[model samples]
Target: MAALMTQFHVSPSGDDSAPGTEEHPFATLPRAQRAARESVGAVLVHLRAGTHVLTEPWELTAEDSGRDGARVIYQAYGYGTDAAEQVVISGGTEITGWREHEGRWVAEVGALDTRQLSVDGQRAERAGIDGLPDGTTRTETGYRTTSLAPQQWQAPASVEFVYRGIYPWTEARCGVAAVTHTGEHTEITMAQPAFDQAKALYNYEFEYQRLTGPALPTRVENDPSFLTTPGTFALTRSHPDHHVLHYLPRSGEHPSHTRVVAPALETLLRVTAARDISFRGLIFADATWLRPNRSQGFLHYHGSGYYEGGDIYTEVLIEGRQWLTVPTETATIPACLTLEHTAGITFEGCRFTRLGGTALGATAGVGLTVRGCDFDTLAASAITLTGDRDAVLEDNLIQHIGLDYAGSPGISLLGTAGCTVAHNQVTDVPHCGIVAGPGTGTVLSNNHTDRTMGVLADGGGLYIAGPQGDSFDNGALVRGNVIDNTRTPYNFGLYTDYGAAWVQVQDNVVGQADNSAVLHVGPPLDHVVFRGNYWNSDPVGSDAVPAGVTYENNTTLTDTDELEAASSAIRARAGLLRTQEPAIG
Candidate 1:
């Protein structure tokens, strides 16, 4: 006979004060956790099918860990017995009391400062403008509007303008500082300059030299003047105690028929200093994040535009923070799930969707495994593992990530050793697909990255940047991946930037990249190897592939014989022919 294990049950219809048995379940996860901590042996917390609205994060510490060849398993009921049921742990509050105003729907959501909104499980666009109004002109200080009344520009501090820079593809958002009516034109002063005018590489003459000759296209948002489109939302506070949300519904959507949800919390779960914990078959969704403040100083690149330097630019702020006069360090926007200082933690068959920050973040952990999960519609990276050892991220589907921020990637691994990122599919991101850096012993193989770098330029589908200080990403193997359709400027199918060294890239299929060369190498490379790769395009030559690099048996798209051979080799090595589909509820 099997040894009896301790068990606790949690259900939506139960009460927390009851005994956590199969018949009488606990209502909240915290109560179940407390009971699990008091037990001596292994424990299984079974969650019933329903929605679990969490106002705050469910935290687990070292005391909650399983010990002595035992484990703690938090899983959905009917996981293996029957078909998977819907178990949604949501961080957002459902909004009610919707009415009509000026041919639009209006509601009051108390002081929730979120930029994302969803109606009937679909993301709605924030009210914005596509281009500048006619007769708008630029000045040395800011922009001037020709036909604007004083009432339209009232409360300038709460307004923001998005400017399409001289390059026409690049964009920047600036807060409004002052707005004045000068009878002839309305002058608007920005809190910061719209874009970096001083540091221009290709369009230096048009961007910096001729400042007032032609006005860049601009659009004002976060105000009430431009709330004309359907499926758009705007938040405004006319009084201190009253916050109004204005929304234009789609053609068939109505206030009484649709389900509206606004995000309330940032973090849904936090596992701290714990060991031997597993979370399975759970869905975490609908958390919000606010963008951090920008810095006054700027760091300009030679070819790219100027970048603001502050807490937003660095990765060290992921741990702790200090807010001084200059705000040297700041807190990270919390993820839907955060794991720190933990070991042997596994997240299996889970789904993370509609989150404002990262989906899953593991910092300073050991033996963390995230397998067979789905990460979708996140504002930041899908998975960010830092300072971890022997971490594994496999068989996951990461899509529609970095929707709000362009700098973060789909999967970011930093300062990690003996990590395996394999067999995942990453697509529809604004930045890189898989970015590893400043680490060692990393194996990135058998992944598929497509349609990446849709917004941001100067990145790659598979990218590595590093060798900072004494930390070297030596002996990292990147092989057997399929990357396609990188259309942004300065982007590539495979890129090694900064001081990346001693990496082996082999036996991959790269196709349909916008740049002529599929492989791109930046300066200060050391001991890199490229062998037996099949490119479905022409090589751009020395500009992308530099000297002193080992290149052998690499063929272009037209060589059908070599291409078929290479494809067969890659498929045999990975042991899988196609990507896995995401698990459904």
Candidate 2:
């Protein structure tokens, strides 16, 4: 004995004139969405095959559901062999002025700063030359004297330079601070000291050779005069320390205009929870916007400021403004697809295309999961996660990103934990594959990245910054990962910043790294382990690796440079092993 099931039918062709009862159905998705919001107990809705123009994106909230488990399901079908054309869900509704603020979704970008914002534990390292101690040099020639005998002279000790760079120096800089000679291997212990205002410590452990070979004369200084720009208080160096730096910039201010900047897809998906909401095989097509840039899109979970159901777009477009207008806030227009502070979101099969901007321009979310989705032709990053506690991005394809000349990264996540980014394919991007910021317990495993370069003036790959707290980052793992054609003119296979700890980089394969410097570790990068990692371009016995770092069972296949970078990488990394630890299976 079963209760009779109540049903509501909606056909755009059947009525602009009906009341939408079981006998009389109304037309349009807006009417259906409205009806579903007000109905109860497993409401099944049908759409007749045809094109439906959406002037505004639909919003689904948590309040639409009833105590008896109200449900709304949509599908297209033919009646009595009277088949219509395939249902075409086309035409994007213009969304404006929504941002993912804190752990909640908001329509106003101004509300983003009203919440608590802080860096997470676990440091992320970027390659910039900052925090190296500026040194002074005075030439001194030693001579053997016998009153009037021919005087024999010896080489000088050091040189002087200026300081104008970024912070939390790497190991090569630490070695420079010790002034170790070329071909002379010196090992130094690394440590992380606390910042005045923040909760993290910074530092890397590295090694370098002197200019004793056919290279040019040694230039001593915190910075070299030759590298300094004219009329600027800066100096540069040819050494490896000069190339790598750490970065943590402030998010730009929010715009104050009454008009909306860019709206997110989640904003329209927030139907009331009283209704059982389901987006089954729906298509959102040709989401062209007033702006042409890739950064603009929609925000989810508006007003109540918590989170809502995932708005799955089978196909969608996100563009930016034609002319660059100075934004009042750091968050500008075209920041696409922000899902902060919500759960139970699923994008089973969808395409996110044409995302641009500098940093967090595309794909900002928290507690979100994106599976079997695709990202294409993006200008900046495909995705950015901020303060997400638990998230999963699995078995997806992200490709053809970074159309803008200022290409950023594939994904950048900050202050996250319990996140799994696995089995994804990312290619033709301009920056690193996945950059995890401080205070994140993230696992980036079994992912494949190819042709990942940096922005015009930046470096590339798996840049890890330290957590805001001095305690080392826990559960940051990079395993079974494959990187191909990581062609950076300068930098490493990986970079670990100071105050970052408890990291494990294992069972990974890297190929055709154009740069010789592979793994750059900042001071205080202790308790970090690299095991069974293979670098095809890195020789097992070269100088490419910095000293004092630990490695085990790592094999390098190339060793043809002045530094023997391959051999150095092996020797330096081998030091980190406990010697008797069992090999990984």
Candidate 3:
């Protein structure tokens, strides 16, 4: 099924007065979308050559058909040509009410499409911009947006003291800048006050009647990792009468001191409800923070498929330095995008890199499929899933993950059912390549891992942590996986935690190991079997002759200490009474 044809074109010198035809096209995308929605079958909206500045999003609506086989499609005509570059709809800049002053346009800083600085109605001097050798201009500089003004330096009589400078955990403390709370509604804005002649002034709310001592009970110092100061403030403010006291921070200081803050998970969920929305071709540098100071999942949709196509290059250089010195903070910073609580969602042909947090984070989805994606240089885990059902993760390349955190895994699966992790390449991560945790009817098959740059922490090709709940029937299968040079700081090629029963480990390959043993099995349940796996740790080849579970035709190359250890772990897990239990319990 298709909607009626709605021809809409955009040009730099066009207006709405023009008819929505190929010759005389509608100038605005909203007009085109509106006209297309009113059509009967389908509307093919075409955008002509030029740039179109948009203040809001343009959403297209499809008409509903009576039968199942009917569908509506809105096709773009000039998507493949430089002439196809005819339409450019942009937002995030505010320019209005500006007259030509000194041969320049004057505009307010309402929104910014480009980073050019402007004065009262006209473009003014710009920072970090210089003329280049080829007569091109470049913006090679950035501003420190986190700095505070100079007047807020002195400490006030009463202040919401946050000392996260250094040694934050031991020195956390909070207090009311004054004895009173004042603001419109629940807001409190305080001014400079006298507290031992400290110039720091605060504006805040104190909901409670009074307290005998300081607002919070902790102290402060100068160190990194500031998890405890806010923890103490929130602890003291748990009472109903306790309220937030606002404090205008000193110059170059933020109002709040949290290491990571991200857009609220709900905002992402709202964006996920649309169809054919793609992030692949856009340069997203300065999007506003829709939500701040919370940790939540990214996106969620109901039976709607999500699409993302894009690339991210870390503007900050991390050659031989710490990565977190940049003031930018996001709690669950997704590289490309995230999809949660969805059905029939698909991710294809995307690139995720230089991420602040996870590359792809998913949870509680059904009929999900991810294909032909590349993940690299992620600060956290590359791909993570939780509580998913009937998902397929296939044909992707994942590498260089956990660059910021040494304990992070490449892929973590928690309570996912009837899913498959297949045909992917994983390397240079800090933890396990694939971890299946307490899930039923899951499969890890035909995946390859390069152990040359193996993770320093525990876990390798596949890690199984089970028995978290009774819902796990141990119907998990691990087969046809390849591991090479996987040097872990702690444990195995395949690790099994508690309640690992009726699981199958077969048809896999392993190359090297570190201090820990390979094929770790612990706190067994019923029939955790290992069979038909190959090993090549020593000069003589050996078969995978695991002792504990029922062995099936498996072989190895050059029996070594690792092979013997694997055999012993199988025996111990098989209840054969070990000489000594493996360290992993």
**Candidate 3 TM-score versus the reference:** 0.48
Compared with the true structure, the alpha-carbon lDDT of candidate 2 equals 0.42
The TM-score, computed over Cα atoms with residue i paired to residue i, of candidate 1 is 0.84
Candidate 1 residue pairs that clash: none
Worst 10 residues of 2 by lDDT: 149-158
Model 1: per-residue Cα lDDT over 195-276, one tens digit each: 3331222132321243322245455666656677878887765455467777888899977789988877888999999999
In model 3, which regions exceed 4 Å deviation?
Answer: 1-336, 452-456, 467-474, 515-522, 537-548, 558-585
Q: Model 2: per-residue lDDT, tens digit, 1-585?
A: 654444566665767467765467777777776776676566666666555655455544554433264445665544224453345454332224444433222332321110001112111111122222223222221111122111110101112211111111100111121232223222111111101100111111113211110111122222222222211111112242322111222233222332111212211232222223433333333232222211111111100011111222211111221111111212322333434344444443445543333212213334456665666654445666666666777766766654432334576666677777776777776556666766556887777776766432134455566653332354588777666666656545455554456677787666667642234443455556677876765532235444534667876665334223533443332211222245579
Deviation in angstroms for 152 in model 1? Answer: 3.3
Q: Candidate 2: which stretches are off by over 4 Å? A: 1-28, 41-52, 64-334, 354-367, 454-457, 468-474, 497-499, 516-518, 521-524, 539-549, 559-585
Clashes of 2: 99
Give the root-mean-square deviation of each candidate in angstroms: 6.6, 20.8, 17.5
Per-residue error (Å), model 1, residue 109: 2.0
| Model 1 regions lying over 4 Å from their true place | 1-3, 134-142, 149-156, 163-172, 191-219, 292-334, 468-474, 516-521, 542-547, 558-585
Best by lDDT: 1
Candidate 3 on 1-585: residue-level lDDT in tens? 543443455454656777777677676766665665565543345555443444443332222111132222322345434433423333323323443333222223221212121122122211111111122111111011111311122222223332121110011123222222123111112222211111111111223222121122122211111112221111111223332211111223222331111111111111232332222211111112211111111111100111111221222223333121111221233433456565555555545544445666676767667666677755556777778888887767778765433445677777788888877777766566777777788887877766622534445566776643333254778777766566644546655554565578776766565422243343444456667776654211123534435655666655566664655433222211112355775
